[model samples]
Every structure is written in C-alpha cells, then in structure tokens.
Target chain A: MSDVLAIAEHRRGELRDVSLEMVTAGRDLADQTGGDLHLAVISGDVDDYATQVNREGVDAIHTVEYGEEFNHDVYTQAIEQLYADLDPQYLLAPNSVNGMDYAPAVAEGLSLPLVTDAVDLEEDGGLTVTREQYGGKVETTIDVEEDHAAVTIRPAEWAQAEGDGDADIEAFDADIDESEIQSTVTGFEEVAGGDVDISEADFLISIGRGIDEEENITLIEALVEATDATLSSSRPIVDNGWLPANRQVGQSGKVVTPDVYIAIGISGAVQHVAGMKGADTIVAINTDPNAPIWDLADYGIEDDLFEVVPALIEEFGGDVPDV
Target chain B: MKILVTVKEVAEVEDEFEISGGDIAEQYLEYDLNEWDDYAVEEAVQISEAEDDVEVVTATIGPERAEETIRMALAKGADRAVRVWDDDIESAGKLDVETKAELLAGVVEEEDPDLVLTGVQAGDESNGATGVTLAEKIGFEWAAVVNQLDLDIEGGVANVHRELEGGVEELTEVESPAVLTIQSGINEPRYASLRGIRQAQSKPLDVKSLDDVGLSADDLESSLAQTDMYEPESEGDATVWSGDAEETAGQLAEFLRDKGVVEG
Candidate 1:
C-alpha cells in the first residue's frame, strides 16, 4: 500500500498548530489513496509532541530524537533516511520557515516532485494541488505526475485534525553524519524588547502605508487607546521604522488569530491576508472602495482615515485628539 | 567575489483574466520584474558595491522579452545577465519546479559564483521551490526567507537572521557558497535612474539555449501539468457603509456594539 508520511514540527518544546493541520491533510490524502497515515517527529524529546499529536487517523507515529531545537543538517539527514525506509508515496510538511528550509533539500535529494504553499489538494485520477497567484487574484491547478511527491501545506488552510488516537510510537534511527553539517544555529533573538506582542492581542487595530506619514500613526494609537485594542501595523509601517518589527502582521511577520482585527488604511495584500485571515471578525477601513481588503472583511468602511478616525473616537465616546 | 541572482518576468494583470485556449490571455497582460527578486537584486548590488572585485550577475529563463527584466537588473547595478531558453523547452510545454531548478542549476554551473541569491517565491506560480531545489542540485548550504543577511567575505560564512512564524527570528551561520532566498522588506529597492537605464542597453546580456547548457528535450521534461486556471471564489459579502464620516462612524459603532465587539 502507498503510505503517507507527515513531518511534525515543534518549537520551544511545544507542538506547533501546523503539526496537527498537516496530520489532517495527510489523513485525507491517505484516505483517498487507500493507504495508512504515519507521522514522523524529528525532535530531541519526541514523546511530548508525539503524545500531543497522536490523533485519530494516524496509523503510526515515528520518533527520531535528534536535538532540542531545529537544525537544518539534522532534519535533512533524518528525513532523507526516514523517507527511504518508510517508502511513503506522499510526504507532507508544514510550509513554515522550518519546513521550507529542509523540505526543498529533501525533495531535491530524493528527486521527488514538490509543490509548496498548496491551498487546496485533491486526488482525481492524479494528485491535483491548487495555489494562489498575483496576490490571490488567480488560482492555478498543478497535477503531479510522479507517484511519490512531497507537499508543503500552508497553515490554517486545512482544519486542524481532531479526536484521540492510540497509534503506536516507534523509535527511528536516522544515523545522521555530523561531519556533513556545515551550519550551526548560533541562537534565537527577539526582534524587539519590551514591544507589544500583537499575535497574542485579542483586538488589533493595524495601520498600513495609507497612514501617510509617521505622525499619522498617532491617530491609530488614539483609536487603540479608545477601544482597548492593541496597536499593530502592516509591513510598511514596520519597514519604515514607525513601528517595531514585532508589531507587524503578515506572512513575513506575525500570524495573528485575534478575535477582532480592525485593518485601517491597509490594502489587503495576499502576504498580509495569510497572517490575519484566521481572525474571528475583521473590519476594514480604507479610502478605496475596490481595495482587496474588503473582500475578506466582515465590515467595510470606504472613507478617508482622517475623517473616519475622529468620528470613530467620538462615536466610541473618547475625546478626539487634534491632528 | 561573485554573486548570482535570478529574476523572473511575471504578468501584472489587475483586471480579471480570461483563459484563452487553456492559458491566460496575453493581450491584457503587462510584464514586470518579480517584486521579490527586485529586493534580491538590490541586496546583491549593495554587497557588490561594499566590497572590492565583486561582480553581480543575473540569470532568467523565459521568452526573448525577458531580456527587459534582465536589463532592469543591470540597470540596478548587475554586472551582466544571462538568459536560458530553447525551442525544445518551449515545445515540451509547461516547466515544473524541478525542470526550472535543473535549468537554473545549469546556469549556476556555468557561472560558478561565490554565492547565489533568488527571490523567496515568484508571483505567478508562487511555488517557492526553485532556489532550494537549485541549492540541492548544486550542493550548496541554504537559508530561505532571509530578512537580514550579513556576509563575512573573509571568513567565508554568512550570518543570516531568518523570519519565522509567530514573529520569531532565528540567527544562523551558513558557510560560503550558499544559496539565499531573499524575502521582501529586507531592504527598499532602488529605482533605476535615467542614466542607469540608458547604460543598461549596452551592458552584456548573454543568451544561451538548452543545448548550450548540455540539456535536451528529455532533460527539460516536466512532471507536473496544469489542469486549469481560474479565479478564486470570493468569500465574505462585505456590507459597505456609505455616508458622511460622522454618520458612518456612528453606524459602525452601533454595528460593532450590536455584535458585542465594543462595550456599549
């Protein structure tokens, strides 16, 4: 039978949400192909992650205790060896920074076809994957010809796998050659100290390039103060040094699942959307009626921010600060 | 020191695209250099300008019109450009990531640069597999989605700060001869000046066919096929509010209060 292997990712000793999401994706693929779904965890302490990820639909959980933090050399070697032994027809990994770093090497080393950032996947006589283009303006379908393929699933694209499972855990030996590794992780550093963590904020009032100038950021800050919301921004605001990098929300920044996300003066680019699309309620305020942000927003207010912010402050029963 | 950067020509279609004969209509399409690669080109140029005897070369695989993209790179301070194309590659139809990576590897072998750089992903396919696959084929250490890069030319290693999920940043050191896929927002790209654009026309842009790269139709064969191209189904039926600012804000406040987003 053609079995499917999913590589689980964990960071800072906790299982990443994408780990469960990949298991769901792998399970669906395995069901379609009439094969078993196996999860491979390559971490120093695999039991904690394996115990947490041992969900329904997984046939077995394979553990390779290599290191505490993610190392490119260790992961690449482990995955390559595991693939050869498992002989899985479909291999899946999360399309995050860690997954992208090693998945390509694994695919290339094994000469397997790879498709990254797949939004939708299905099997209709052959494996068909759908991906976005031009900032989600177009969708393109790709059909993989090879029976064995590697795919990276974007986070939150698929529903997280649920239910408990009693899949047996097995110790896997990768026999990693330490001499082949040429890179080392020096350490992890926070982007900014004493900065507001926007990802953890329940209500975010984020601004973008439309803020006009650095001084205009005060308007968003006043709104945040009035509404008990946290101040965040798009990449332009962070790149311009108006806001700290930790406050930026987008693909290259933070993936936030805030309860209420108020996007102000932000034209929704796909990269930005990928980060905040999971919010429970989204409110967009922009001057352009045709802005893509409106497409995903639950409420759209098309107007100038200078006019809207004062009114919003007044409406929220807060004193309007002079511009 | 030599640096190689890869740029792509992508179609900029703001309007809804119409599929004509299983492909996007070419008439309404306007081509521009891939946005991500622009940052990569800028990074390479900045590095080259910082050091002595440093040369920056750019390569692309596309139709003859792709030369304009290469010229754009040259205008931004690339020393030279190379275009890899062949009739057989075109005749064989759609090129998957593997084929494209192999083609890029062919050019990398020819250049044999000290470091290679590419955009994290292209705008069209958005697969993000080319640079990594090329690194694998050429056996180079690699780091993807790099936002901050510091090169130690003498030590032959690169100290790169990679952006990860949840606003995490990882500092890693990779030995020289590595491939780095540059993420946007790394640095603001400089626009080509009038003089720069004029000078780009005379810069050397070498064109090579697949045969010259020692590849034939068989080698260029793609394992992936495009089944269809269509518009994504729009989600969310946004309720647009129109009125004077005060009235709109009052309405929004009322709506949010009704939804309990804001305390009354």
Candidate 2:
C-alpha cells in the first residue's frame, strides 16, 4: 500500500504534540505520493487514543493494547505487528526518548531502511533528512532509497496537523509471540521535583560559554526571577559543570520553543541554536556584536551582560532569588 | 561484566566547509569517536572501574581507517577492541547506522554482558535511534536520554535518572541485563593517556563476519542510501557592534523594545 502510516506517541495521558506534527508530515508525504493515510496507536487504553488521532485526517486507526504502563518489549512488539499488518510505504514517529527506543528496533527487526531526525521532507518520496555532524556545526541532507522507510522526526520542526475527521477505529491484536519480546519496564522512575521538561518552558533565559564564571549566573538568575523565566545554559556551561546538563539548551540537550529566548553572555553556537532556535523571539546580549547569536536574535544588545542585566532587573522590578 | 561499547568514525567538523562537485569531499575530513558514543564507552569504563567484577570491552564496525577510532577508545581506557574488520571503502561508506546497530546488536546478543550502554545520540549521524533499536531487537530493557545511572548489581537493578524538560525524573529501579542510551554530559568522558594507547594495541579482539552474529547483510534494509556526501552550508559572519558601554546599553535596550521582543 502507498498509504503513509503515522504512529501516535503519548506520555502521562497527554498526546505529544509531535505526534500531531507527524500526521502533518505524513499527510503531506501521502499527498505527495498520492497515498492513503493510516494512524497506529499502541497503549493499554487504545480506545481513547484511537478517537484522538482519528481527527487528523486518519482513515483508519489501529489500536493494540498491552500493559497499563509503557513496556519497551510490548510496544516494540506491537509496532512490529502493525508494520507487518499495514505494509505502508512510510512510517513516521517523533524523534524523542520513546521514539528513539522503538523506531530503530522496528527498523532493524524488519530490515527496513530508517532515516531519523528529518528536518524536511520532499515530494516523490525524497526524504530530505537533516542531521547534525561535528557537534551540530553542519546539517547534512540525504536522499534515502528504501521503498518502505521508517523515520523519526525531530520535535518543534514541523507544523502540527489539524482536521476534524474522527474516522473508524479498529482494535489490533498482533499478539506477538511473548518469547520475541526482549525488554520489560519493571518500573518507572520519577525524578526529584516531578517531571519538568525545559522544552516545555514558556519563558527561558539561557546562558552560554560567553558568560564567565559560575558566580556571574546570579545576574541572569536575577533576571529570570524578575520575569519568571526558566534558568538554562548552553553545552559549554554544562561541560564546565557550572550548570547541570538538564539545563542545557542545544542540539546535545533539550529542544526548547519558548515564547521569549534570552541569551546572556552566550555567543550563538550552532549546537546551542539547534535547541532554542524555535523560540518565537530571541534576545541575545553579548559584548561581542559579531556573535552568531545576534544574527537570529530579534533583539540584540551589543553590550556587557553585566551592565544590561542589572538594569533589566531594576527596571523589571525584581531581584535574584536565593538558591 | 565484560562490557562492549560501540564507537563510530565520522568526518571531523570543519571551520569552513565547501560544497564542491555537488557533494562533500571525503578527504581533508576530520573524524572522531562520536561524542555520545564516547560517553557511553566512558560511562561503561567508569562503572566497570568502580567494581572489581566488571571489565570494559569496545567494538567498532568500519573500514581499516576505523581502527584508529577503536584505538582512540582504547586510549580512553577500553579493554579489548574489535573492528568488525572492513577493508572495502565503498562497503564501509555504504554502511548505515541501522546496519551498524544490527551488527553490533547481534554481536552483543552473543557477548551477553550484564549491562549495555550507548550515547543517546551521535554527533555524526545524529540519528539517536540506533541504541533503542538495537536494544529492542536483542530483547533488552531499553531506556533513552538517561542522564544518571546507578548499577545495583547486588539485586540486579539499575537506578536510572532521566532528564525531563526543567527537572530530573528518577526511575527507582529497572531490572538489569538492560540497555541504556546516555545523554551528553551524563559524565565527563576520560581522555586516553599515552600509557593507555600502547596497551590498547595488545588487547584481545575477535574479528568475525555477519555470520558470527548469525546475521547476513541481506537482513538489513538500506533505506537511507546516502547518495552523496558534501560539506554543510555555512553560517555567515556575525554583525559586530561597538561603542561606549552605557551608549551601547541604551542602543541595545532601544533595539530590543523596538523589535517587540521586549516591552518597555
């Protein structure tokens, strides 16, 4: 079948927005290839999800159930069954922790060609996959040749799919031979303060290698507190152990799409840009006017972060919080 | 636990890249062990070094030139090394991450270590999917982008710390005999010292074909046929602004507000 198969991904009951984006990407590719569209959902409760993904122009929704929780073996087995059942020309999944887990295994298991982190797609089945090389400096594009390809899309790149078609939902029982299932999630670990993803932040004030010394972060921290912005940094800052990698914003770190992205003492590095470039508006404050950060910045302050930060704090009516 | 870490040999990131002849030139290219893969190997070594019960092993599937990659890892402290032994440049060039992952996965399935680790993503291919894929195929408990890992060999559990957006999520315990794809900065990878380099060449490595792992190249699908290679597009020079400190600050503020990114 020339139908484009799109997989829906969810966590903690919320359907990841990228799943919708995958539908958009899938639908576009389907249109380009003149193919039908099908969506697959694997979960303990596929009924609700089946209805959800159907709205995105899905002609049919295939649901497979397993444990109430996410088990890698269970999901991968479910996916393997779906691929065998549908035989769609292309399958799309988001390039995230979960997607990274399943897509490749499925690709490998079936001996299918897989191109991941695709930044763009072209008509006529030419998948222009944009991937970083050399620490995110260069993005290489490739045209894959496999007829049945599986791809994991990077988040925040594609526009979300929208439609009002709650099509037919069908329960799928791949009933994979349990012996083939390799891994099981014996448990799920929740981090200390609950799940707070930096990628989910609405406002972010990210620091970079341009900022000198650990103590200087208090200024940026002060600004963040003034505006309730999340505190984050680039790879170099984390590499130096000034901040934890969780707070890093770059290709090597979480991809952020905040309303306002403020960079202090950070010269824009490509690696860092990959994570935060999706912001609606970017603000870069560096003494170096020639910094690459300034190019993408909607607003640029070619001045010392030291002086500009405090004035913003004073004008914005706030002081640094005690950490 | 004799651990096996996989390293990739990719082109070096260049200062200035040119698009010549409609493709990237293979020569004058700089390559290193994929940074994330390096972390995976580094973490394995650190864990094994911590416990007396473990040994760190590394393997790579690339051309003869890839020997250097395995050697570099040895320099970083990997014990035994294997290169899946390739001399054909075109074959190596055509080998995709899926093929690499499948071969490594098959090999590991046979090696059967107590724990397996890989970088959550690679700097070169940047696919970030191979570890999970390999883990899935081999039937190992798989986790990705995990920032912290604590081995509980006594109970055969792995206490994993996963990084969410603004916070850290803890996976209290997962029964080991598991696969972990490490995110960058989980730990600082150790650089190989001169002493380690000399010892690496003497380490034991077994060379086998796809048959060794019960796999044939026929089992893999080459969907991502890299039709061509070329240097990436460049970011133009930045715009430099200069003036007095106070004056620049005022101009900057004005620019910010005017641009609507900041509201006065």
Candidate 3:
C-alpha cells in the first residue's frame, strides 16, 4: 500500500535521460509516502538499462526482457502484470513520446485514475498533480481521489538521479500473449537530414506562427542573410511547409545550443523552449508583451517583427526584401 | 469502408486573461478547432478523397458551441458528424482519461468503423491519452504520434511513421480497425471554401445523448478533480527595451554587436 513503481523508458538500445529523471520523481514520492521505490525496465538490453538506472534511493529493480524497441502492446502487458504483482500505491512513467503510447493503455486496462505530463506531484493527505494547460499560460492542480493511481511525469522537469545504489535486481517473467500483439515495428528512419544541422549553429534566427503568411517568411530570410546567422523556426513553420523539418527546433525537432538565439515572432511554448534554452543570449521580438518567450529572453522588444526586422537588416548592411 | 475522425473545439486563451473558479474566464477564451485535430480531419478527408466507396465521419464529445467547429470540419470535407453530449457530460468537469475513453468507446461500438483517426492531443487540456485509451477500451490496435500513414485497405494494414524524439521516426505496421492519433504536418489542411461552407450547412449533423451511445450517467463519473487553477508566476528576467521599432532595433543591433553575434 505504501510503495511506488516507476517504469523506465529506453529507445534504440540506449537508455533515455528521462529514465533517471523519473527515478528522482519516484524517489521523492516514495519518501513522502514512506514507501520503497521500485523500478521496472522492460525490453531491449534490460539488464544493462536496469543497472544504469539503479540510482540511489531505489529499493529494487525489476527487469522484464522483451523486444528490441518499444511496442505499446508489450509495455501494456508487462506493466499490467507487474502492477498486479506489486500493488503499489502509485505508478510513475515518463511522459515521453513512447510513454504517451503505452501509459494510457496501461491505466485504462487497470481501471486506475491516470494523469499525464505532470510537472509536479505531491502527497499531503491525497495525491495532487500539477500540470500546465492552455499551452503553458496557466497551471492547474488535479486531485486524484483514489488509493492507487498512475501518473506520467513530463520529461526534463525533474533533475536526473545521481550516484549508485545497492538494490536487488530480479527478472520478472512477463506473460506476453503473441495472439494479442496487433502491431509490428518494421524499421526505423532518421529524418530532417539535409544541408545544415541547426544544432551546430552559433546564432539562430527562429521564427514561429506569428510570421502569419508564407510569403512573409522571406523577410526573416533576409535577416538570416544580413546577420550571417542560421535560420530555424518553431513547429508551425515546418508544419506549414514553409521550412523543412531539419530547420525546426523543438522537442520533436532538434535541440540547439547556440551562442545567441533571436526568437522573432515566436511565443515560447514549453515544447519550443526545450530545444533552444541553452543559448548564451536570448532575444525575443514579439508584438504581444505577454508572450512566454519573454520569460526566457535576456533582451525583449515588445514590437512587431515587420517593423523591427527591416530596420535590423538595414543596420547590418543587408538587403531588405520588399514583401 | 468508414473512417471516424475525432475532433474537439478547444479554447485558446487571450494574451491577457483572467482565471476564475479553477477555469479561465469565459470572456477571455476563444474557441476554435484544435490545431492537432485539424490535421487529423485533413488526413481523413484526404484518404476519403483518394479511395472509392469510403465514408468519413467525425465524432465529438462537446457541447452545442462545438458544432460550429464540427461544421468547419464538414466544410473541409467530413461526410457527416456525430456529437455526443448531455446534462451528465456537461457537468462532468475536467474529464480523466478513463472517463473520456468510456464515453468514446460507446461511439466506437456504434460506428464500428474500419479506421479511427484522432489528434495527438487537444490544445486545451493536452491529455494526449484519450485516443489510445479509447482504443484499449474498445479492443482495437492503435499507434500514437503518427506523422505519416499509408493505409492499405486490401491488405488490411496501415504502415505508419510514429514521430519519436530527436528527429527520429519509428515505422510500424498496424492492423486495420485501428485507432491512429494523428500528429501535425502530415498533410496541408485545406481551407474551407465558400462553396464548401454553403454545402456544410445542409450536411447531416447528428446529435446524441449518452443513452444513444449505450452509456449512462454513471459512466461520466471521474476520480480526478481540478482543485485549483491560476497563472503561473512569471520568471521573466528580461531587460525589455521600451521604445518604438527603430530605437528598439538599434538597441538590439548594438547588443548583437557587443556579443559578437554580428560584426559592427
């Protein structure tokens, strides 16, 4: 009744960073509930992943060796069987792309109350999970009114667990039904490969939805030429086909560590920020003063990009294109 | 063959909005079709156009206001629409994944479509679990965060590209009668033309209650409750330049030169 079970995530035969972060989240919850923190690593080099994620404060590590990569069916079955055996008070999983794939199915199969993308979790009298909504404009706390529940922590929210620990590692035989497996992983592909890698840039001039029409993208291109900086954008630009996927920076895109990131007409959604927050100097040019980009910017200009961009281009002695 | 695409009318908060009673103030929120679901709707419409004898139906668990959004989908090209709502669902504030799955499962059973298409997540709550949860609830195969889908109707398999992190994509083959949560950028969604808008007015928009979908008030019960809602404290330490465009641009140019971002 007073135990926590956390599922670790890995991909392509390597452990993801979120696994260690979940360890930190699970250990905190275990301390609050006065319980032991147990971890389950399923699929693809399970023994190695289990040993790597065996951070301090973990009580036990359960290995369920399965397929090479993530198959939601396999994870769903393994986690369900593990849950029935352990009966932990709360189940923790990472809200990564793969986590979203299986966590919901597990919760539904087990008929437990589920919360996803939790940025904060606390246990006072009951479990309260804090999450961002309306695209990070506001925060809300949801109370789970059940003895047992499942939550998926947002990746990179908590610091990764450090140091080694002495924990018991055991192999859990997951009864996988071959007949029930409806999906098969055929192969993998690396996309967004092209002329330039945004991750290797020194300065990035990023654009977003605020650019509006597709024709207006040329205005930003002029800035890129004038400043000799690389051109990147938030998700919308790539989604609109105005830019290629390789030129996008975000969670599903590329993580960039530029010396300067000039975010023009881009509101810093959490997903977009995850890619470029490591910039040495951040500048935001947006019309809306309340845009979230200001939170991350070292210098902000609450003005329209249409007016400021041309002037900046002229200052850099670059040709300004007529839109 | 039929494809059921799930759509939602989500609220986008204004730049400056107020929070009241664990929710955003009604006046400050603008309702529109969710960004992700727009792509899902476009994918369904495109598939319907490409194949023969295919019907594209959309389902929504929203109130009367959402019909405007449903009509937008119809204008873009869904065959018809089914909306499930009642007093019980209206009062079910902040629905959890299980509750949403149960509600949508009833619709899935009634429709019995060959393929289910839904957005990766709604823009408002961003739960991102209802599609897959509903798939599990109805005992169907599913793939999440799918950016590319190639459906082979004769073979009864859909080859999909699930967008993973760090610019990697995992390819999978999902059995037909599967639920696919569509990601953005799969295809360019078409804008609703005036002719399409006029035609959508006469399209079949069916409204149903929980009983219509073989459910009851008990199914709306959820274990999760929103206890509090508020604006997150701003952590902005930005040095904002207060001036017109030219002055601010000059200040920015100077700063860039100082940081060696651009040569002076």
Candidate 4:
C-alpha cells in the first residue's frame, strides 16, 4: 500500500480549518489506497498545530518547527526532504492562498504531476480528480498518469475531520537552506475597514459585474436608500473601484451572514459564495438563468437587473436615480 | 529593469451552451485576454511606466489566434511580445502544470527578464500553479496571489501583499529575479486608446516555434489527461419569480418583507 502524506496549514497563531479538512481528504485517499495517512505541520507553533491536527484517521504527525511564519522556501525544502524520507504515493495540501504559494513549487521540486483546486477525488486502481474550470461553469475529471502525484484541495469542499485520535507526534528536522529562503513574511494587515462593516448588516443589497459601469451604481444606491439596507457588492465591483473595499463580500473580503442578502447580477463565484452562503435568506437577480448564484438562492429572478433594480426601488418606495 | 508577463487568451462560454467532444462547443466559446492576466499586464505596464528605461515584454504560449490578445497587452503599454506555438502545442491537449512550466521556462530562459509576472491562474483551466512551477523550473523566487507590489530596484527586493482569505493580506518581501503571479483588482486596467491601438499594430509581435524557444516535441508531454467534462447538475431549488421585471421585483420585495427584512 502506498502511503499518503498531507500538509497542515496555519496562519498567525491559529491552525486554519482547512488543515482539518485536508486530513479528511487525505484519509479518504489513504483508505482507498489502503495506506497510512501522515500529516506535516510546518512553521508557526508547530507542536500545537501538530497536536491540534492529530485527529481521527491520521496515523502520524510530523512537525517541522522552523520560523514563526510561513516562508515558502523553508516549506518547499522541508516538504521535499519529507517526501524523500517517506516516499508517499500521494501528497495533499490545501488550495488556500498560502497553499498556492508553495504547493506548486513543492510539486515541481518533487518532479510530480500537480492537480489543484480539487473538489472531489477518487481512487480506483488510478487517481481521478474532479475540478471546476471556466470560473466554476463546468466540472472536469483529470487522470493522474504517474504512480505518485501532488494535489491541492479546495477549502470547504471536504468536511473537516473530527474526534481526537492517538497518532504518533514527532518533530522532523528539515534542512533549511539559507540561500533558498529568499522571501520573508513581514507581517499581516486587515485592509477591509471603513465606515461600514458589511458583516454586521441585517439587510444587504449586493451588486456584481452585471452593474456594467461605475455611473450605474447610483440606481442600486437609490434602492439601498429606499430599503434602508447596507450596500455591498461582489469582488468585481470593488476591484473596479465602483464600491469601497469595505463593502466587498467574498473570501478575501467579508464573511457576511445577513438576514437577507439580495445579490444583483452576481454569478456567485465560489469565492463570493463562500462568504455569504450562511445568510438566513438569499435572493438573486440576473438575466443569465445559468448563473451559479441561483444554486444557493432561495428566490431568483431571471431578468435584466437594470429594469428589475429600478422596479425593486419603486416597490420599496424609493426613487430611482437616472444615470 | 525588464519585466516578462505571461498572457493567455481564455475561452469564455456563452450563457446557454452545449458540450461536444468532452469540451465546450467552439462556436459557443468567445476568446479574450484572461481576466487575471489583464491585471498582470496592467501591473507590468504600470511598473514600466513608473521606472526609467524599464521594458515590459509579454510572452504567450498559444497559436496565432492569441496574437489578438497579445496585441491588447502591447496596446495597453507592453513594448513587445513573443508567442511560442507550433503543431505540437496545438495537439498537446490540456497541458498540465509541469508541461506549461517547461514551455514558459523556455521563454524565460531566452528573454531572461529580471522579473516575471503571470495571472494567478488561467480562467479556462484555473490550475493556478503555472507561475510557481515555472519559478521552480527556472530557479527564480516567486510570490503568488500578489495584490500589491512595491519594487525596490536598488535593494533587489519586491515588497508585496498576498491576499489571503477572510480579508487578510500578508505583507512579504521577495528577493528580486522573482516571478509574481498577479491577482485581479490589484490595479485598475486602462482601456487601449485609439492612438495606443494604432501603435500596437506596428509593435513587434515575434512568433516562434517550440524549437525556436529551445524546446522539443517530447517536452510537450503532460502527466495528466482529461477523461470527462460536463455541466454539473444544478442542485438549486430556487423559486424562480415569473412575469416581467416589475412583477418579479414585486414578488422579491414581498418575500423580503415576509422574511421581516424590509418594511412597507
């Protein structure tokens, strides 16, 4: 049986939830392969992260106590060495932002085929990974041709592993190369603060790329004024400077759980959906009936947002602004 | 300073489309510069504009059809471009991260730019691994999902903000001669003006074959194969409000009020 080795991700002082989710994914793969599941937790309070991630199904936890924060060079070297030591058939890591930083490099260094953002994985004599393409419009299955491969799982796709288990916890000294450590994590900053915190709102009116031009935002503003709802938008609106960064709702922005999240023209990209999927009720307005937002929306209106938004404003006793 | 930005022409599917031959029907697919690459191009162009004697060059691994997209980058401010393509690449069929890294690494070896920038991922494939993989292949430092960049030419470093989940940005300092995969919304990409478009038509668009870039047909081999492709069955149970815009809006408003979110 080929063993499965997965990496645990930690940020600041906390072990991110994705690490536990990765354990579940790794356990599934190991079970299919009839191999042991080993975990590697590197950098940032390794002992605690190792102990925290020693959940059910994990057979061993390897802690590499290096620098205090994530340094890709150290991670790459540590993982490469760990792979040499263990020679596992499969390597799994989270597809989070930090995972994106190092997983590809690790795969490259190990001379393994790399598959990323895997939503589902299956092993039947061979490995088949299911992932989304074209902004989550379609799903595709990729067959890894090699005996050993590396994969990065999308966060939240797999359920987090629970229940404490007795797993072997040991520190593996990774040979950190000074020359390869070229990048340094200076610090972190929260850039999404402003007069409004969208996460705290109960009624929210969110817009997306379907709003078209910056000048057209006033129409939505009129609706927000009428309904007394906080105004927010998908990442594109904030990226286009049509709305403030504080009003952006997505994985890189705010996690909003409003009582009502009225998504106008938002196709609900996976990142955007991750933040607001917990809302009490969701409503989507878009002309494209195939938009992914409808999958999560409790109510949907497949019509032009321009006509419907103004109509929505009027219904709420608000005046529509002409652009 | 010279910057090499990797650009790709991505296929965006129409709202209602059919899948044929395990891929989106060609007729229903529209080609355009990848959204993330647009931002990368903008970041490179901005760096070139801010610095003296800095050249911004774009490199793409696509067929002749991608020249239109490369011209867009040139129109926006890239000095020139190099496109690596041949029958081998055309038939390679779904190049994996390693194969793509090998291809782009060939270009990086020839051009030898001090800095390399690419979109975090191609919109169509969305692998999000090419940049870092290429860095490993070519022995260059790299930072992924960079949303803000501050170049220290004298210090030989690139200070960047890596956008993380849940509204956090990790500030990092990367040693130069690095590849930075740019994220969208890092900067507002400007449209190509008429004058710029005219200039772009006359700009140098060097087309090369795999051998020209010091690569062979064997290097195009990928370790992954696509076995299936299809639209995921919708799990949505949304109550689609019918009638015209007004009627639908009325229904939505009523629903909101019934949920105690809005008032009459």
Candidate order by DockQ, decreasing, is 4, 3, 1, 2
Pairs in clash, predicted candidate 1: none
lDDT of 4 by residue, A75-132 (tens): 9999999999998999998999999999999998888889999999999888999999
- Residue lDDT tens for model 1, A1-323: 38899999988778989999998999999988888999999976899899988999999999999778888789889989988998888889998888888898899888888988888889756789887766666678889997888999888788889999899999997898988787888888766446567878888888997899998777777877788888888887887678878788887678899888989999898779878989988988988655678789998788888999889988887877666
Q: For model 3, what is the C-alpha lDDT against the true structure?
A: 0.92
Q: Which is superior by TM-score, 2 or 4?
A: 4
Q: How many backbone clashes does candidate 2 have?
A: 18
Mind giving the per-residue lDDT tens digits that candidate 3 earns over B124-241?
8999999999999888899999999999999999999999998999999999889999999999999999999999999999998999989888888888998999888888999998
**Candidate 4 on B230-263: residue-level lDDT in tens?**
9888889998999999999989889888888888
lDDT, candidates in the order shown = 0.86, 0.71, 0.92, 0.92
The docking category that best describes candidate 1 is medium
Q: lDDT of model 3 at residue A26? A: 97
Question: Residue A305: error of model 3 in Å?
Answer: 1.1
Q: Runs in model 3 with CA error above 4 Å? A: none
